[model samples]
Target: MLNILRSHRISRFAVIGGASTLVYAVCALALSRGGTGAAMLPATAASVVAYAIAGLFSYAGHKYFTFMSAGAHAFELPRFALLNAMGLATAIALPVVLTERLGMPAAIPIVLTCIVVPLVNYIVLRRWVFRDV
Candidate 1:
């Protein structure tokens, strides 16, 4: 009963979340690449831009595919955006604290963002942002 629904929901969430992750990684890595030339950006800056793009994809995917939400976009979108902004803040801060302050490689924060953001998002998205209506 509840377990079945939860299992099905988890699978759908994985599909959409995976896509969003791919979008974030591609954009972040691409933007972070190249030489010190103007075309390149610092890892944290690239991550910020990439996450913004990925967040939009995630909202659409989670709305239609993951949660199959039928709720009003006006209501759902604002909440969804707020949830993602928290994730974004964490994503932005990780590099600042980890790479800049601690002198860890940028990859560490980038990898942490990939793993941590989705985990937190799933919990919040299921319970709050895209809760069953």
Candidate 2:
């Protein structure tokens, strides 16, 4: 447990993730103020923007710190973009469906979906997208 927590790569990834979440939350809040009905598009757009910005940092951090890929390869950018797109879709769709379609609180579905998706994202990214080993 301690060894896993102490991993330099994981630590850096956590930092990047935390920052991205902060960005998302701020954007969501600002958008949500315009009434719930009006908030959806702006919030979604903001989330996508935040994901892109955060993903850029995440890819660099994972390459250098977590998985320790020395430099970019021909396939790296496209593969990374693809993985990020999948993660972004999951992140966006789950929250929207749970909150809007199901009439649940935004926070509940957002939190629950976030918890679920990260596990999947990590597995996909580690094994398929950024396999350093």
Candidate 3:
């Protein structure tokens, strides 16, 4: 646990994830206050926006601090974007489905989805995007 926190890659990714969640929370709150319809749009938009910001940082952090990939930035960004799109979709869809369809508390699904997608994102990014192959 201590070793994982000490890792530069983990630390950087944690910070990025934290910041993105902050963005999502703020957007969700504002939208929910405005109207029910506004909530989903803003939530999804916030996830995409936050993911874009975090994705850029994750790429640089992973390249320099994690895997230290030798690939060109041009190649890496597109792959990163693609992986991020998948993660973003999961992040947005799960919360919406849980809150709207299942009638669960909105916060429950949001928190769970946020927690779950980062693990998936890390695995996919590690195996597919930044792999030595």
- Per TM-score, the best of the predicted structures is 1
Question: For candidate 2, what is the lDDT?
Answer: 0.62
lDDT of 2 at 91: 59
**Per-residue alpha-carbon lDDT of candidate 3 for residues 40-109, written as tens digits (9 for 90 to 100):** 4545454455556556666676776666778777777788888777877876786567755676655565
For candidate 2, the C-alpha RMSD (Å) to the true structure equals 3.6
Q: Pairing residues by index, what is the TM-score of model 3?
A: 0.64
Position 101, candidate 1: lDDT = 89
**Model 1 bad stretches (over 4 Å):** 34-39
Model 1 lDDT on a 0 to 1 scale? 0.85
Clashing pairs in 1: none
Score residue 92 of candidate 2 by CA lDDT.
80
- lDDT, candidate 2, 11-88, per-residue tens: 666665666555555555455532255564544455566566667776776666666665465666678788778878
Q: For residues 19-117, what per-residue lDDT tens digits would candidate 1 score against the true structure?
A: 888888888777876213353778789889999999999999899988889999888899998999998998799888986788776667778898999
Supply the TM-score for candidate 2: 0.69
After TM-score superposition, the amount by which residue 72's alpha carbon in candidate 1 deviates from its true location, in angstroms, is 0.5
RMSD of each: 2.2, 3.6, 4.3
